[model samples]
Target: MEIFMKVFTKKLFAGAALSIAAMSSAPSFAGENPTSPIMGIPASSLEEFGGREGVRAWVESLFYYIMLDNRIAPIFREFGNPERQIFLNTQLETMVLGGPNEYQGASMSAAHADLGITMTQFNAVVEAAYNACERNVIKYHTCNQLINALAPFTADIVTR
Candidate 1:
């Protein structure tokens, strides 16, 4: 476990540095609330994700991917009741679609502060989410939109 964590930590910082360099030209997300809904998404966007039920299904798939990923699966083992987490994620995703905010969860930073989450894990989770959206047959554009809305939360999620 110690060896694995050491290797993981090394990769984590390296990936974080690379990501910072790559996103240097990206527009500032300053002043954006990580938990706030993204405004201006097309009304039909929620339909593309097949509404709340479909979003829940996608979140389930996302968890499956997370569990299958060795690089970050251990982090999630610290939590319990995957179903509850999926439900919360579904609500969060629904909220991100400019829908009703039913997400009864802590803020991203507070929720993850003690986890020592890293950019490598964050990116891995993002890729898993994208794959989940694809598997659910959500349109390509809508998947990108979902990811874009969630991307800015990296600042709140990654605790080093």
Candidate 2:
């Protein structure tokens, strides 16, 4: 009787272990694709970043800081046409929000080539941009991801 009980217990434990393993390895119903460009984050997730309103607010704040609080403001004030600024802002907002718009701004390097932007100023702008995103309650990782995506443009925008 003892031998029979021992075998039964072992089989029960093995079955339970297999069940747990299967559960762990099972596909989730959430339809997540871990390798996607959006990191499996759904568009609905934008709600957490304040949706369209949040995106607009963030872009406005970023422009305000860059155009007012930073030395770059003077450069823009000297050469930036108001209409161009408005168009750029719109394009930036659309791009940032994953909307259907393409940013056709001058390549970053060419844009800044004549201005002689320093590393310090570039860093400051980057910091200000992130701060603007945070002020609008954008998710940290999402904001970071967006920043990372846009970062390659620095090569085009930043220069000696």
Which candidate ranks first by lDDT, i.e. highest? Answer: 1
Model 1, span 57-88: residue lDDT tens: 88999999999999888888875467778877
TM-score of 2: 0.60
Off by over 4 Å in 2: 1-48
- Cα error, residue 148 of model 2, in Å, equals 0.9
Listed in order, each prediction's TM-score against the native is 0.74, 0.60
Model 2 over residues 41-146: C-alpha lDDT tens digits? 3454445556555666676777677776555677667766645665665444444444433445654445567877655566666666778877777777877655
Q: Model 1 shows how many backbone clashes?
A: 0
In order, the Cα lDDT scores of the candidates are: 0.69, 0.53
